[model samples]
Target: MKKNQFDTKLIHEGYKTSEYHGSLTPPLFHTSTYTFPTAQHGEQSFAGERDDFIYSRLGNPTVQILEERMAALEEGEVALAFGSGMAAVSATIFSLISTGDHILCSKGIYGCTYGFLEMLENKFGIEHNFCEMDTEEEIQNLIQENTKVIFIETPINPTMKVIDIEMVVEVAKKNNITVVVDNTFCSPYLQKPLTQGCDIVLHSATKYISGHGDVVAGIVVCKAKELADRMIPIRKDIGAIMSPFDAWLLLRGLKTLAVRMDRQCENAKKVVSFLQSHPMVKEVFYPGDFKSQNYFIASKQMKKGGGVFAFTIDGTKKDTQEFINHLEMIKIAVSLGDTETLVQHPATMTHAVVPKELREKMGITDNMLRMSVGLEAWEDIVADLQQALIKSNSNTVC
Candidate 1:
């Protein structure tokens, strides 16, 4: 049989209308436990002799549908859903690392991910180092014997600096290190890290996969089933499974993933152009920009530039806030990949937990702003930025 295209798979890959009362949409199974025909069946389930879902914590029908769909989307063998983005991050890292293990990470990471790494080092004797990973040699230099995992966020969170996945994977493969890429920024619509040789790909499904800001969830897709098996026990023990209702919402959100991302990518290009030409904008960093350092890598791995980008303004932190405050439509929010355009200041808002020195080392600065270009009309979004930049210029601290 011929394979379905990417967009078609997003909507229909893991579901059959006839399986659940002929409903076109996948039915939500909202129960905490599943019934068994006999005590023998329950015993078998507990012993792992049968594949029945024993409890919501272990598995749920609606969540399984989501997992299956995401696995297909990400081109992975298995996918697991989680209660929050941090939960998925925690479970995947814990599954791959031991108390004495070391982790090598990309230079820039989401603030909560930085916090989680800090917690692991302080509490469990696990340690990590952040590297620019500009080349295979740089990644090789940072690797230690105890390094068990290479965790990276391409387009590196708020900075929007694209990393070469194939370069990292090449170095990791030579070292027998497990590579995990955070696919939150691009979602599966624009990028699939597993296809580029990463061992696992994960996302904060609250963003693009949910689209509406109504759900907080995460998903992890592993290239191999052994990795999935490793995470299953961890997710179950940690009790961070996604809710059935959240899975249902994601299912609906995913059906429009392609179209939403298409519009966002187009909108972001126009917004980037406006920001670049604005006198008050010092510089913009987006892989979509033709002259960006890693634009070639981004073009190789991603279908498009994606919806998020960052810029540093010709102003102080106070002026940056003034700009954000003056925006009439774009929101001042930490989260990204939504239908609504959102902006955040990393120095004060999201990356505040990291020390100033470390945040600076991560290329996050007081004058920088990260914006997730939304599904709004490009002209309207640009108008908001124009007015905000004008207001911000006036309020600059001289």
Candidate 2:
């Protein structure tokens, strides 16, 4: 297959035509081990002298195809898949950092990622600093000689803050630090972090890449062969390898990512406009909002505004719950990047483990809500929002 463009790459870049002329979709190879042609061949495979699969933990044909496709989409040299999003996250971080190393991360990270960093701090004696401010000077000052990784999530978790990936890479490169970007919200279809100078880019493939909420998976794409080599041991030893069946599912999902995201981005923009005009909304944090402070960064880095938005409502946690409960079509859920719309109160749900004071300080208040816009018609979604807002207003009246 010619490695043409992203959309073409999505369908054909990964796997070659099977010699057997099998089904169009890659079939599930549910074998534990491959039979060796001879004793010397087995010895060579086990010794890492030849490129051959030794165990299921090491690799599978289906997983390899997904990895290749992901690597192409992400524009990375190689990609690794994990059983779950956190598995990929943990394996990547663990592969990079040691006991005495330091990490500089964004303040408004995904809840579980924040927890992972906290655990490492307590148990591993590693050092870290959370920087809410993404100004180049602020981040540069925070970096120490021991800083091994500069971790960030663009259009950050629930808040939708955009970090300048180029600026981050420039700063990290000065001190020879690794730049690990979680490109979950903006899938490879919308943004390619590795091409923007990030050392590694990982995603919760269960999200946009899968397009459906049926599977839970994660993948990491790295620019350097060395980083890919480093992660291989951690992936195998940690035992978080993605299942062959899930890999096949992910491959199928990748085929239509471009189309799904196109509609998703459009719907998200309409939703943002509606929220911005609503009387109940206090603040709207969509990258498409040109007046936003993060707009400049978003314009520089992302091709689209992405499919997620976070806005503030004029109410408490109870009030927010009322609004969510009143919604007709949008599901009140925790996980994001699905076919159906999802809305949730980040402070109380996603970021609940975060310290109260810190959460409040970061603008993750009880009044805030995060929405993952789906493929639903814009008018229907807006109508649902209208009804929910009515309920929210009525609750205030009482």
Candidate 3:
């Protein structure tokens, strides 16, 4: 079959109806183990001489399909699927680094990722430095002889701070460091980091990739076969493999990702515009917002501004709670990239685990709100926010 465009590829890539007796959709192979055709076949498979599924923890037909699709989507040589995003994150970190090796990462990242890195440092003797990865000079200043990996999250969680991936890649190349990017916020539909020189692109498929918010999964796409080969054993031994059921769900999600992302991006742009102009909003952090510090870099790397954005309400913590309580259409939720619009307070919700001083340094303030715009009509989303803002401000003297 001819390779089609991205939208067409979403449904057709890495799959064929003939393989499943003309079934239109990929069949879910839910069995924990696959039967070998012969005793010799089983031995060969176990000996790593045959490319066959032996166990679900090692590999599965349904999971393989999802991995192939993710690899194609990410423009990577191979992709590995995991039970959760943090599983993929931890596996990648462990696979790449050794004790005494150092990792340089962006200071503003998911709370769990921060915690995991801390755990690695405290328990395993791995060292890490978290800093503003805004410039080559800053990155160089922080790098040490032991620095082996540089990890970053673009359009960083709750802040929407876009990192310059290509620039970072250039710096990493000079230092012989591996560059890993968490592309969860801007799924492959919005950004392809590997094309810009990233070594690996990671995602929390629980969010936008699954689209419906029904599955919790993660994926790591490697630009080089060597890197992928190294990660496979780590994942297999760790037993954090994605389930056949969730893989099937992710396959279904991939079919609609193109359309879902398009509509969500449109809605997000409109929502950002409204928030930027609102009297109750102090600041809006969105890639598409021209006023954003990283707008130019975002435009270069991403096709759209994505569905998620952050903004601060002009109020105290009490007023922020009032606003959240007044929201009727948008749900107060921790996870994002769902069909229904969701909003959360980052300082108290997603990034709450981070030290208060560190959270403040990262600009995740108590009054700041992260909004994940969905496929809902933009007008309704804006109306909901407008009312919430009104209710939050009504009791205030200012």
**How well does candidate 2 score on lDDT at residue 74?**
87
Candidate 2: worst-modelled 10 consecutive residues by lDDT: 14-23
For model 3, residues 86-174, the per-residue Cα lDDT tens digits are 99999999889988999999979999999999899999999999878888999999999999999999989989999899999999999
TM-score of 3: 0.98
lDDT at 113 for candidate 1? 96
Which digits, one per residue and each the tens of the lDDT, describe model 2 over residues 168-264? 8998998899999999999998888998999999999889989899899999999988998999999888899999999989998999999999999
Model 1 has an lDDT value of 0.92
Candidates ranked, most accurate by lDDT first: 3, 1, 2
| lDDT of every model, 2 decimals | 0.92, 0.90, 0.92
By TM-score, how accurate is candidate 1? 0.98
